[model samples]
Target: MTKNRHFEIFLATSPGLEDMLCAEVKLKGFRQPKAVPGGVTLRGGWPEVWRANLWIRGASRVLARIGQFRAEYLNQLEVRAKEVSWGELLRTDVPFRVEVSCSTSRIYHSGAAAERIAKAITETLGVPRSETADIIVRARIENNFCTLSLDTSGDLLHRRGHKEAVNRAPMRETMASLFLRKCGYNGQEPVLDPMCGSGTFVIEAAEVAARLNPGRSRHFAFEHFATFDPEAWEQMRAVKSQRAPEFHFYGSDRDAGAITMSRANAERAGVTAYTTFNQATVSDILPPAGPPGLVILNAPYGTRIGDKKKLSALYRALGQRMLEHFKGWRVGIITTETSLAHATGLPFLPTGAPIPHGGLKVFLFQTDILK
Candidate 1:
């Protein structure tokens, strides 16, 4: 019989991406996931955890909650920590680390709490609390209520195990996915990224449409857990058979080097058949051959140089081209600066999701029709 597992999963995301993360979780079948400031909390088993890690594009990491308790005092924390199911979750040989965050209600010292929890894991589970931990388990003490979670994905899933090549100010995969979802891309319509840098948007969209598992080619921290079932994980990974999609995913960059890197990244992602890379400027982009789809661009805002003389004209030209060519389609534009976005000259509204990228707050400007 299969175990009726009950575990907590935390979907880690950027500061402004919490709602989108929760929305993605719900879209992935989680009926009720509590949206916190930086992430979401849900209860489920290993299967749900695996699926979230595989399909959640906005999530950086998925952590499985293992324990929760209230400790008003350090002595109570020590006592409550002893009753946790450490033997079931950790092995004697595995190395682990404790990360603690504390708020009101008597847990005043976060470092002390983290040390106590690490000691408890070491004493009870026989697992050494090594600094170089294969897995990072998170502990949060809010109003003296403590919650423990184990990191399932060792690294951020947006790494995608591909993207060896990128150019100046390349957008992150997580943000790219969020913007695409905001555009309502269903993978059935043609998608184009005229300013594609390293093909992040196109590659991630292809992965989504083909039903490919984003974590298939990557490794996770949960694989090293004591309760990890290799056979079950293998079965889950077998679902990665979804390959090329029928919709066309076109990516173009003015730099020939970017186009070459896009093709290489696409091949590595195993979605080359569904993607096309070209060396073309945004002004040169023509309407796709198939039905009208979405056009997304993360143009240069010249944040560091503070030069707007040329980029302003670029934005105006971009808006002009979209108005002239992509008449019936939709467009999604992410910009670090509002003034540059205003120069687009397109009829658009704020997506209400302000995300952080490259240490700067960004917003998504979307228009269903280019007027």
Candidate 2:
């Protein structure tokens, strides 16, 4: 167990966007943030953890590493787990769940390892265990070393407690923010998503430009922790750095239902004043009345059999429209197939590393300002 309040906090993000996430963490003034394989790691206490959850747009979840020990067997694990100061972190009245993973360890049975630790918590802290509990205790037993962490964010950070309505295959807000960073957006320029499904890109851009906190509307599991300070958290949340954006973000889709969903989502996210949604197809999309900016979209790529040919034609049409109409504007197109991206014939720079999204490998194809 940690003798002091400070602990290592891990901000989990999608695999391929670690660099962008690290950039955001650095820009946000996080202390000594280091990019790892799956996410970024920083050293801080509870307050830093809370702020990361509230402000970091690219993180999918926040984890607090509480304690660790070496245990070669289940008996040793149970004994060592009981020795940790559970009362310092967990409340007896609250229910929690334990999830464990084991690899290359003598105590290789993850189920048994989880059971031993859960038993220790139940016996030592008098807390009840439930599979559906919101408070999570995660344990990993790898190479004879055991590490324990607490899931501070109750739900995924992408939920954001807003955006109730969504379209099919909607882009997550976390992914959208990272992609925007990848496109070199810094809240000063305008953004447009021509095939906006549920208005994710536009709403995210508006939120970034307005300097809104993503977790302002939501509750976290850490609120129930014994170490949580409600007063300090309230003060942190009360401080707003909101700024007026100079330009508006826009989204348009061929489906009227998608436009309706996007409008509702934007309103719920409190970006309606800075965002606009329209019902229009890709061929009909026109540049908004402003200085040239970014045109980013997550177009549909046929995942099923025989869907690629039709999507190819759609891509060609999209490319032709942008080539003819949108001069001096950059484009970021996300798709699963390079052939579909090739159909656009946009002067795309080198394709980025493939990002795993919705069980398919997707890559970002970007271009300089179109001539």
TM-score of each: 0.93, 0.97
In model 2, the worst 10-residue window by lDDT is 1-10
Q: What clash count does candidate 1 reach?
A: 0
Which ranges of candidate 2 are over 4 A from the true structure? Answer: 1-4, 304-306
Residue-level lDDT of model 2, residues 283-304, one tens digit each, is 8999999898999999898883
The CA lDDT of each predicted structure is: 0.82, 0.92
Residue pairs in collision within model 2: none
Count clashes in each candidate, considering only residues at least 3 apart in sequence or on different chains. Answer: 0, 0
Q: Stretches of candidate 1 above 4 Å error? A: 1-3, 240-243, 304-306, 351-353
Over 210-315, each residue of candidate 1 has an lDDT whose tens digit, in order, gives 9776777788887887778889888877865685677889999888998999999999988899899999887898987877888997877878334877788888
Model 1 weakest lDDT span, ten residues long? 1-10
